[model samples]
Target chain A: MSFHLGGDKRASLAEAAARVGDGALVALGGGLCARLPMALVREMVRQGRRDLHLVGSAHSIDVDLLIAAGAVGVCEESYVGFEQDLGLAPAFRRAARDGSVEVRESCCATVLAQLRAAEAGVPFLPVRGIKGTDVEGLHPEYARMTCPFTGEELVVVPPLRPDVALLHAPLGDAHGNLHLDQPFVLDERFAHASVAVVATVDRIVPTAELVGAGVVVPGHLVAAVAEVPYGAHPSSCYPGYAYDRPHLAAYLAAATAGGTALDEYLARYVHVDEDTYAKDVDPERLAAWSGSTRAWQELFR
Target chain B: MSWALDAGHAAQRSWTLDEAFVVALARTIRDTEAVFHGFASPCAQVAMHVAKRTHAPDCLLIEGATYAVDPVPVFVPPTGNDLALHRDAVYRMRFEEFFDAACRGAVDRMFLSGGQIDGYGSTNVTAIGGMPHPKIKLGGGGGGGNISASIGALTVWTSRHRAGRTLVADLDFLTDLGHRTREGSRAELGYTGGGPQWLVTELGAFDFDGDGHARLRALWPDVDVDDVAAATGFELRVALDGADGLLDPPSPAELAAVRAVDPLGVRRSEFAEVELARTPGLSGVAR
Candidate 1:
């Protein structure tokens, strides 16, 4: 009942996102400074889904890219990475200037409200804790009547119920149970808030082997599973892996340098195909490039 | 060169003239103090002023807006999001990937303020009027005030007018439930940090008692207990000995420090004026 699939197999990222429907709330999972599914997100952007609502805590290159491409209509709460990480993507800046996106504070609250709403089987949940601040005006939906006892004004936030949650896990089983050793704040909530959840993992192991591996989002919440090796590249999976800083630096350079520069760069490298991009860059060479002065300087330039 | 605390004539003084409060606030988080600040907060501006001037020359000021620490130059990208300042510093990754460090308690301290906080320290930043059907609609509360109560030590402050805005009793919406009503529930839920430690306001200071009620800790000099009582929408228990009242006014030395740090008088003057306009009666103080 929790799973649904479109007819296409090996569909593009845009096709996957299309299945989510319009005005759908989407939740993303990754590291504070990890790589996100940008290639997939690019596919979503190419599809030009304007009715999508994005909610997340921290900023990622993928989110930045989406916002740049005009894919996100509303952002509940999120932070933008430093410009160097952003590459040449100016979409976030343009959106803020145009008042297309409303930035609020606190990712946990946004995720939690959705989780509570889903758990309570309600359309939205009322929350407190932000009052007499600018956040009240930014998120007008949360402000409420003065307390009967206290006579003070309150801000109420509605719960977030996403139609689909797209997450990447380090390991999983065929049945979709996930194993993420990292300590995350809102992944559990994202799992609960979604009508269906899709998880992409690096490896597929037996369900019995995951018995004591410290599961964050349980298997039941996960709808479908896909196995993709080194899926969390750019974004580290913690104990299992680390971020590919060189590839990320190169990506940052191309993304932040301007659209023309990005096009030229991606054409020479990333855009041809995932396999071509993967084969073109030598892992050993990337590994040899230390996350040092040269790397940072190159990224900015 | 001299520090003088004058209780009787405190209100007559300007932020430029009064230095004690600035000095105390600055000195509090000088060395190795992991302080957290909220967005668009004037108090945070003052804290930054203090931190840069007094103590930790290399202080790690972690901003919610951005993650690049010191040595990272502050560049205000055109977007107005301070996080953009560090965008160049962020490595590419999936979104929501950063919570690993945050959940493991990488953050040390946080600054927070609330609307309609109750006796239980529960804050509501939700809708006003009513739940399903409300007379007045409000912006959705963000973050649910969880970060404020979850951090190691939370310094809560507000600059709102006391009369019609503040709460006298329990809140209509619950943003953050400060100290849980029952003792065992918090630990049972896997949260290990203490609740809010301090509540500060333009009028006075408050702290939660062992029994889980806010107790008045201090009042601003030149502010009468009646003024505070009238301004507060709720009935509050005053200190028995009146020891919590402002006895020693803010000293000139403190004022000098504030002036020296904020040479343009940004925190005390224009900023205060902007905040005062939002809350009535404070306009006189601003002028």
Candidate 2:
């Protein structure tokens, strides 16, 4: 993995999004509507990035928006749907059905194993169960080999090294050291496996303050960092805010309708700068997320 | 265990299909088992909670999206990964840790559902047609393929069975392995878990036969073998007990526990509008 040692690694939102080149394999760092890098995602849409391949475990609107914007050509995620809140992701469903996007379906454990292999600098990793299903047949690269000690057959998956890892955390330093809260699904592993890591955080605290938050990702592992408050708006960044269900519902309605409805939505939201978008999302509503548990529960209602 | 019928009618209470469905699912888990259900599964989530509250208090209840262990939520939220589910959790399980534990066969039971479930218990959540290109793209099955083989037993459930599209003869693709496929049996393939131990649907509950095919074992209120045959794509085989398989709805205790855990009735979202409207408590429940 590549690293940027020592010096300040802060960059603007545009610059951070630009680091992810066209067609780069990006490992998005979040699982299902939490701590997703939405500010950077909007920035990439505004910049008109194209033909990107996204890989992740469980996801929702983040990947769906990119596919809706025609930025993604290959989707290797295990699950990409709104769990319980809604149903299937609208744009992703349409893209896959139309054969516009290549869906290289992989499971959560397999994806984790591949990333672990890359982090360990191993060629492949053996998984316990995945052999006796049709999912295994989709990936021709998966090889079956007998264990050396016990004659048991195992499925060996090749290492997955993403070109970039896009993440959004709660705290970070100018030197790019990240402090993510708990339930940081695979971001640390993503940092270790990817060639470069790009992140957006809610606050840029002092290095000491970041260390206190728990520096899960060291400065040396990161290529760039951007301070974008409410960077994960419409998706919760724990202890900061809760996901905006109304906003997400509006987004789904527009995406499901397609045509000019979706076009108008993109123009109104995705095309704008972070500051403008933030203003559009009423501050009072966001404040409610930071209140007691009752307020947090009210957001879903 | 035979539930006392007098206790049910004492409160002059009625039950919905979803509540009964949850009870049927909860019955699959033993008190000693560690059960897991994935994200977007409110029915299974409520079922696990009911089981823990009623018969299986010692059972380890794991949250799907958040991986919280033995969580004591105030109420089941519509979303899976929120702090609502993680409240008062005994321990938070890491993403990889759950998979590793299941692989080692530490996890006893897991609830799985598919876009299409075949007679052999193989499921398809990947696509509708074929791979690479498909007529319809369902949300991919998250770790179901790997964990289905690793866990102790699988409780397969589906709400869309009445539509005649869910229980199919052949799947477009097999996302999780069942008892046996065209290639061979799961034992021959070295899978640790007992494939599909039970299949619970809106119409009835099914148990695997000697040959590992889904055989209808129990029918819900007013559901007969003909009704199940009409909905299922494959040939329906009834249990040898026949009419005796017609089972009672969930008892008053089970229904009360189900409503307590799911105050907002998040499990109702899993069923169709018609199904909800047909049931007394389901459609009129206050949000």
Among all windows of 10 consecutive residues in model 1 chain A, the one with the lowest summed lDDT is A80-89
TM-score of each: 0.51, 0.95
Candidate 1: where are CA atoms >4 Å away? A1-18, A35-39, A46-50, A83-89, A99-107, A123-126, A147-152, A245-253, A265-272, A280-301, B1-287
Write down the worst ten-residue block by lDDT for model 2 chain A: A282-291
Q: Please report how far candidate 2 places residue A53 from its true position, in Å.
A: 1.2
lDDT of 1 by residue, B169-261 (tens): 755545454664332333333344456665655666667677656667666544556766776765576662332422233345544445544
Judge candidate 1 at residue A222 and give its lDDT: 65
Model 1 residue B255 lDDT score: 49
Task: Please state the CAPRI-style docking class of candidate 1.
Answer: incorrect
Most accurate candidate by lDDT: 2
Q: Backbone clashes per model, in order?
A: 74, 0
Tens digits of per-residue lDDT, candidate 2, B54-157, equal: 88999988788788888887778787777777767768888888889988899999998999999978888888886877777888988887898889989898
